[model samples]
Target: MDFFLMVISGAFSFYWVFLFTTHTYLLLILSQLTYTDQIIPFELSTHPKHCLSVGTRSRQVRVPRVLAIEGPGEANARAERTWRGRVPSERQVNARSLPQRDSLHRYEFTHPQMGTVFRLVMYAESETQAQAAATQAFAAVDSLNASMSDYLPDSELSRLCNQSGNGQSVEVSEDLWQILKLSDRFSRQSGGAFDATVGPLTRLWRRARNLKEMPDSARIEEARQMVGFQNISFKKGQKIELKKTGMRLDLGGIAQGYAADRCLKILRQNGIRRALADAGGDIALGDAPPGETGWTIEIPASQSKEVTSSHLLTSLRLANCGITTSGATFRYLEAGGKRYSHIVDPRTGWGMTHRVLVTVQAPDATTADAWATAISVLGESGWKKLKRKHRRLKAWLTETPITAH
Candidate 1:
């Protein structure tokens, strides 16, 4: 659930399609051209069966009827000539119409592994080629998800978690190794603000929220014992080991961003230079659309005091970069009048209660995603410290106004 959705091009363009969770919904704005920035809160059915397909609908293309040719070589030559230039009016007698040459072909589909709808809008000569490229990109995303997801017991990450204990080591896939390395680096860089070893605390908070009861302080402290980046070790040849027995890895924070980057890479491999990969709102951009500097991303600000809902705080036109937002505006638990965000502070083993939204922009999606989660937990003081160290990192923060009873 997001308080605000990221607007790609064309108002509610390619990225607007999302699969809602049972407890969460989305705020979708209709065409900005027509509505003047009005938002509609639409609750989607949580049933796995329901999926929304968005983006430009394809127009029917009428292929030109070709006459019989004598030989294969002659037919090939004639086909090449036909594609290069216009055929005579007599040859065009049966030609109907072709898709607009300059039009962009967008293919939207739900990722099988992630269970989230992703849009791949590409500039291609034909719909067939666009669909092919989009399919390849989704396949890339699925491969990454299959390896990184902790939800699946047999996933590579889970396999590593199960093998790690009592100073034991286990060799992992290259993908897992890369993500683990990143998690370790960010954990150290953020002063424990970002940690993949926070899985135990995450599970505890998740269970507590599910039962609508806050976890006891004693239990949270106990879980903290099993969590620490220093407790985990990574070696060459993609080997990883958790020094503690109960340590686990949760890539929820940065895995999607990595996957988005991979999807963009795959699209480029298929000759799609201009594309956008919105992996559940963790966006990675390729070259911008034709004639534009970059893709416009709408970052939602807090709802105005006069308004009842959220709107775009600002818009960023970005090219060849990644952007991610972390906030408690959605998917938070309210217990005893305190709002706890889903993000947990690894150091304290507790969910963050501060109502702050943090958006981070980075050279890549993985970095952006991890930093966004880390900065959200760090709050203003911690973020200032981090910014002092990293001058190039760009961020935006919006805090909810605290009200008195």
Candidate 2:
């Protein structure tokens, strides 16, 4: 039952719509201004929900609704022109309604992918610095996506996928190699639940999902034969190879976390002290802002529409820690009145039967990301196994009621 819930949570969709606000003088002259040190008090309303107070920051800025950059290397067209168009009107309303502060400045940026929106919040020492940091963060996200996404022909993942697996080792970047090594360790520790070598199985299930049908049992068994951590061979000096030609690899499960980690690195390197990277909920936090407890996360309940609780975790303050949640709420196929999740159990060569949501917290995004998937596959037994392997890692498993809530 615990395992079932972990699986459901691991794949559930948690959507966030962030509003950023900036103050203009037109509202100040109108005698309807809320001002304090140049910062504005704005109310952000999200679709299907609303957040109140949520607290105030130095400045509030929203990303102009723009066309979303689609799959790798697409033209820089407007992603959402309507949203962009609405920004001015919204800005005016916020300017008229909200109070302003002198010293506080807020800037926001949004990117759409992974079935949800990604938001970044920046509060800088100066308005110029705030805007500049927000802009840099947005560009960094685009660059990070360009580097990590499957869209780029020259992406590390794309190159790794095309490499021959004739038992001859291929050299990869330290970053990619670290991800692979961490994946391997998780694979062994989770009893093969988190194998990166299950790329073949993932591909198969992806096709099944598109078809909205269960895969052929015989074919699934055949794919299972090729899916195992044992099939991958790794060596020193960042070399790796698959033993079988038909075997494949997919980092979709962990790439977001890795990218978040990389983004965090970039932010720190650029001397930005306090920042949060929300790569579709594979969040990485840098130093916490003064007087802030930590990043506030909404823990969604089994029902997709509601959040049962909220957690303000200081765990992000610990260097190198990342959080990943996996569940079966999104990306599933239903056939003959039965639903199969997209997360394939490599050991079984089939989609997971359990409905579980698993949230794992670990030292890095990569580890947390992979472990969340792996431990979900392991179910309760996998949970026990992971406890032995990673004493520092913590997990929370939530399951759908056999009887509806």
Candidate 3:
């Protein structure tokens, strides 16, 4: 499990504001005077891209691509990668370690996107700018989530899934199209370990988790028939189609990381040079935080209560890269003395049975998030082969060390 505690202003109000600098709608903060002026204020600039005309007036803003989605814990049942830090539990955020009245102010906000708490941390000279920047960054993630979330029945990805088994190519947004292409590329590269078409299997295991039992073999097989990344058809002209009916696309593994990357972009564009956008476990760091050299993180070997600090598998200082850790610690199904991870292997129509915790660091959050799960599915041997093939990809896997040969 990952823990992040961000200190932010307590004053806030709830309202949905849709603002845009590009074709995608950005989730803007709505308020007055102090909050509103700093965030999405109406102003006129020569840059048409940044200004939206309203009642013969234009508001100044930056032009950039955005995605949209509802707040967290408000939608259908989706695993949400379980990395996005939710409302920080008492143990997650340590208040004593934090600095007081620092030169660089830090701001945090919780978005209901991905069904988890997305904590955006930004360092700026003033509290107003930090709050504004964090708001925009989270809005960027909300936009991406709106487009990629399978939980939303009306989402772009869900609509695409509805067009499945039609044997006809349907046009998709550039963002959705790009994500599907990456999904296909990684799915092939990982040899079915990282599959976007594992929606059926994920749902099955989710049920098993609730029941604390294993799924029936027959139902598993039925879902398996609809689970295959190879069944997706990506043709020319940015069109895609599911090869079969009953096939669902779940971006649980990669979407959050991609959203994190986009959030980083939004932060940089807003002149925020140092920040950390932690989309659950998928963390994208933009430079170091203020005076710090790099962001510090710990990678543990297992979730076992007995595992101590000395048992740490890896500790990292990360900057300008994406870090993701995948394990069965938080969510799993246990039955017949066997514990199953929520990460379903699409090829086998089952969950990851091995007690493996895999962490990967890559140039981007998307790759790191997807590869972490893929490496976990591959286990030790697959990781060795993959490491040899992708030299830049860093991974650490700790498997069942209880039993000796």
Candidate 4:
């Protein structure tokens, strides 16, 4: 499980909320503060280190230690009024309570979806509005989960998988279509590094996780045959076709990031600008709190050794974007004295055996999520090759284990 430690503006208690994603879990940090006109108290989550070890976990790609955002001069009315969130890096989020009130209350609400907890911390004037916005946002998540989850047998994604190799294209919901497009784009950009079609291998790997042994080499090869971005073709009008009979589309890596983004959108639509949506550990932030310039994200500084890793907390303050970290720290498999991350490399049907954390920041969580997975596979140098192409994104990496103090 991923550990999230929080220390807010005033007196705050450390709380650990567990969210299960894939075979991994996330420890969430939440704090309660008085909802007042004064600058809204920012709820902070302490990351184990300044760098995040990202892997196929987010099924993601790019940025460095610090990811920049749209500056005040670069932002417009809507953009200025909007804010961004962060991942497992030094990105910060500053916020205010609320201007005149009348929005989602300064409260946190959560629900389980996509194999993790979807959390929303927002502000509003009336409890009624807060409840209403939460209800709508959670409802959207539930609906989206039904559309994307591979675990659900009758989910839209499952239905499409069932149609694999039928030589027929299936029309998807708008939401699913959007995610598919992203999956395709990243898959191409990362050179098959971040593929949603890694479902076959993931299924086999899941068994490996439970059985405590690596899947048979032959089985891995068999599953790998069905895993490739080329196997799934996206047609116009939201039609998706799986050319392979046993292809499975695994969106585990990036779905939550997209969900986090949606959560922020819903919150904004409900008149809540100062908000943050933590989908599992993937973060989606909103406009600065009531008075602050941006949200502050503190990631502990890290020093990696051959066998262990240690960290000191480091903080960065910024606004308006998405962030996610993928690593094998909490979720991985140990077989034959080897540690395997839960993130399955779409290229090779094997979980990464290294100890690397990848934290990616981008304009949205979807990009951050997918790219984190890609970067985990690509390494820092690989990202640096294409870093100039994605100027708005930043990534950070740290390898080894976290030595507890």
Q: Which ten residues in a row have the lowest lDDT in candidate 4?
A: 56-65
Off by over 4 Å in 1: 1-107, 301-310, 399-405
Best by TM-score: 4
Tens digits of per-residue lDDT for model 2, 294-347: 444434335332322332222222333667677675678787776677888888
Misplaced by over 4 Å in model 2 are: 1-104, 113-116, 127-154, 300-320, 399-405
Q: 1-405 in candidate 3: lDDT tens per residue?
A: 122222222222111122233223222222122232222222233332211110112233453211111222121112121123222222222322221223554555556679666656666777778777778877777788889998899999889889888887789989898888899999999999999999988988898899888899999999999988889887888889898988889999999888888888888888776776777667777776543456665566665646344555554666888877786766898888888999988889989888787778899889999998898788889878767778778887764121100
**What TM-score against the true fold does each predicted structure earn?**
0.71, 0.65, 0.70, 0.72
Least lDDT summed over 10 consecutive residues: which range in candidate 2?
A: 47-56
Query: Candidate 3 — which residues are off by over 4 angstroms?
Result: 1-103, 301-314, 399-405
Query: On residues 1-405, what C-alpha lDDT tens digit does candidate 4 reach at each position?
Result: 123332351223322222234224221221112212122222233321112222212211231111123332122222222223322122223333222222223566778777777777676767777788889999988898999999999999999999999999999999999998889999998888799999998899888889888889999999999988988788887899999999999999889999888888998898877777878668877776543466666444474534332353555554678877777777788988889988888888889887788877788888989998998887777788978888888887875322110
Candidate 4's TM-score reads: 0.72
* lDDT-sorted candidate list, best first: 4, 3, 1, 2
How many clashes in candidate 1?
Answer: 0
Error of 3 at 404 (Å): 31
Candidate of highest lDDT: 4
Question: What's the CA RMSD of model 3 in angstroms?
Answer: 23.1
Expressed as tens digits, the lDDT of each residue in 1-405 for candidate 1 is 243544434345533443343223323222221222111121233221111111212223343322222232123223323433434333322222221122443344445456555655555556777778778877777777778887889888888788767577888888888888898899989999999999989989988889889899999999999999998887776788788888888888888888888888888888777776766667778886543466766555664423222544565677888777777766678988899989999999989998887878898888998998999999988898779787767888875211100
Q: Of the pair 2 and 3, which is ahead by lDDT?
A: 3
Q: Is candidate 1 or candidate 4 better by lDDT?
A: 4
